[model samples]
Structure formats: structure tokens, C-alpha cells
Target: MSIIVLPQAFAYPAAAVVSTFWLTAYQMINVSIARKAAKIVYPQMYAEKAQAEASKEAFKFNCAQRAHQNTLEWLPQIIASTLIVGLKYPIPAAALCGLWTASRFLYTFGYTSGGPGKRSLLGNTAINAIVQLGFILGGSTYTVYQLLA
Candidate 1:
């Protein structure tokens, strides 16, 4: 039996799946925590009918925060995935994608917990940079490989 190497395009769908999982998981966790925090902070605020309306506003704030965080986390994945498709370097691309996902998880935890701002941002940014570099290198390598072959 002979094994065949699949083309780089195959990585696109896999990367999408991974990206979706990471983004969705992070957003869900953020929203969950935000909701819980709101409830804790405004316990009596939601007691009466008018008060419920006011309390709902707090929940909305949490939702907005979750959306903001989700958007920030998604930018790197979008860039990385595009590069993976263009470059067709599956192995390194996939590895970087995994690292990006992990870093986002750590970032979400750090951000929600009010960890040191510099440390959290630095860690997340480093991972984002690594993913970006992989994409650039992968594209260059693919270009060379295609030219040679």
C-alpha cells in the first residue's frame, strides 16, 4: 500500500474548524463569566419590574464586552487562515493555528481575571506574531516549492 500526501488546500477546512472551535469557546466562556458577574453585582437591581429592565442593561454590557473580546481574538485567526490557504504549508500552519488557539484561551482567562495588563497582552501578542510569521514564511516557501517543481 502507498500513502499519498494531500494537497495544501485540505488544510483550509481543517483550519476553519479549529478556528471556529477556538473563537466560539472563548466567546461562550467570556459571556458566561460576564453574565455571572453582572448577576452578582446587581442582585437587587433585578428584583422589581422596572428594576429588571435596569438590570438587563448590565447584562447587555457584559454581552458587548464578550463581543469585543471575541472580535479581538478573531483577527489573528483570520490572517493566519488566509496565509495557510495561500501558502499551502499544512504542518507549520496547523501548528501555529493550534498555538494561536491555546494562547487565546490563556488570554481570555487572563483578561477576565484582571491579570497584569502588560503580561497578558504581551503573551497574546507574541503568539499572534508567531502565527503571522508562520504564514509569511509558509507563503514564501510555497512559492519556492512551486517554482522548483
Candidate 2:
């Protein structure tokens, strides 16, 4: 059989693909954790929300759910955009993707453990805004904008 070879340049794109997998799994796991936490805290909740007033645990559970949902709503664009960009500047795409993943993790932990108004980095709001902008800007600068051409 002939040997298949990949260039050294493939390294960063490979890493970026791994980062994408990690991030997708992280979002899914966050949802699972949220559902399990809800089950533990409120056994009455099967598929629907509990009718009683929200408690601290409930709020924490909601935080996890929202975290997963927010990522689902936004991150896919960046992930796919990064893949497109990776053809040219894989390392930069990988770095930006990794940074976003890290920020999401911190946000998830701080929101679930501390409360609604906790700071994961300088401030959760600031961190979220920065990461979102980073993806849009990074993707645009990297190569996503090329698609428009």
C-alpha cells in the first residue's frame, strides 16, 4: 500500500479539529450535567419545569441549561467558520477556538457554582462579549470573509 503523507502545515488544522470536537462535546456534556442536576435537586421535574418558585439550585440548573443553549446558538457559526479559515491560517483559528472554549468553561463553572452575577474572568459579561466578538472578528480576519469574495 502507498503511504499517505500530510505536511507539517496540517498540524494546526488537526489541532483545530480536535478543539472543535472538544467544544461540541463540552456543550453536550453541560446540557447533560444540567439535566442531571435538575433531577437531583427537583425529582418532580421529569421533562417539564417545576411549578414552584425557583430556588438557588434551580437557578444554578437554569444557568447550566442556558450555558449549553447559548453555546448551541452561537458557537456553531464560529466552529464552521474556523474550519473554513483553517485552510489558510490554521494556527490562528485554533488559538481563537481554544480561547473561546476556555471562556465558555469558566463561564459555565462560575454561573453554575457561584450564582447569576458571578465573575468568571474580569467579568462574565465582558468575557462573553469578548469571545463572541473574537470569533466574528477572527473568522472574518482569518478567512471567512474570503467566502464573500
**Top model number, lDDT:** 2
Model 2: how far residue 10 lies from native, Å:
4.0
Each candidate's clash count = 0, 0
TM-score of each: 0.53, 0.68
lDDT of 2 by residue, 1-149 (tens): 99855446657756765765676687667656766755544453323355113555555566666666677787667677566666666677677667766777777667666555763654656766775676566665656457466
Ten consecutive residues with minimal summed lDDT in candidate 2?
Answer: 44-53
How far out, in Å, is residue 62 in model 1?
5.8
The C-alpha local distance difference test score for the whole of candidate 2 amounts to: 0.63
Q: Model 1, residue 51: what's the lDDT? A: 38
Error of 1 at 83 (Å): 6.9
lDDT of 1 at 45: 22
In terms of TM-score, the best-performing candidate is 2
